[model samples]
Target: MRRHLDRIDQLILAELRHNARIPVAALGDRVNLSRNAVRQRIERLERDEYIQGYTIVEHTAEARANVTANLFVYRTDRMRGGEVIAALKSVPEVVICDVMSGEFDLFVRLEAPSVDRVRAVWQQISMMTGVRDITTTVTLSTVIDRT
Candidate 1:
């Protein structure tokens, strides 16, 4: 059983995050590990919760058709593996959330059926504990989305 992620394990996870569909052999080559070894480590990472699962992020036509926005959330306190973030996971429209370094502490990307939905999600987010202020920007269109 794997306890901690070593340097090689970290490298494997990093590559997987960039491209989950990458073949195991290709992943191994990038991380300088044998294919079998890489496979074993990935399995262990999943079991140990170092990795949750593989997923694909796409800018599909359906996705692109929706109202997209970035929410810059200012928090009163630093995150503590807290309920605020956990609550965000339940908001279906929120596709991504990040901890930032500057004026804002949390950044969220939300794609909703309409602008109204985006406002509704914002209301819910603003009411959560630790959330002090939120600034939202609607995305007009994607110039280049590599994600």
Candidate 2:
């Protein structure tokens, strides 16, 4: 069964999403609760799986300058899909991966210094165990990254 969140629980989640490192005292002030109360609520949220562990987003000049590429992969050998996925995960060039339905079995997102580098990565992927066909799209500008 799924659990329903109340208004206070939703408020806590929203505030945490904005800044996970926000101190309990500050969070309490914003939510009109005591520090201990806020802490308890946060703990409950974690226990209930509403709150996952916090993460940090590191932004570097190299990351900002790199070109983002999306690759759509079609696998011929469905049985070897797991091996192909593991190989993709091992490659540092692959930043994101997803198993999809339809023509392509896997979708990958990567960052490279140039378009040529993206092509090289695609070639490497194509040579991997299950990869059959690859199509790529280079992103010109990112309007939104709702991560």
Predicted model with the maximum TM-score: 2
Model 2 TM-score relative to the real fold: 0.63
Candidate 2 lDDT by residue in tens digits, 83-125: 8898898888899999898888888999888888888888899
lDDT of each: 0.87, 0.87
Q: Which stretches of candidate 1 lie over 4 Å from their true place?
A: 1-61, 79-81
Q: Lowest-scoring 10 consecutive residues by lDDT in candidate 2?
A: 54-63
TM-score of each: 0.58, 0.63
Candidate 1 lDDT by residue in tens digits, 19-137: 88899999989988899999999889989988876666755778567999999988888756367788899999999999888888889999899999999999999999878899999
Deviation from native of the Cα of residue 72 in model 2, angstroms: 4.2
Clashing pairs in 1: none
Model 2 CA lDDT for position 42: 90
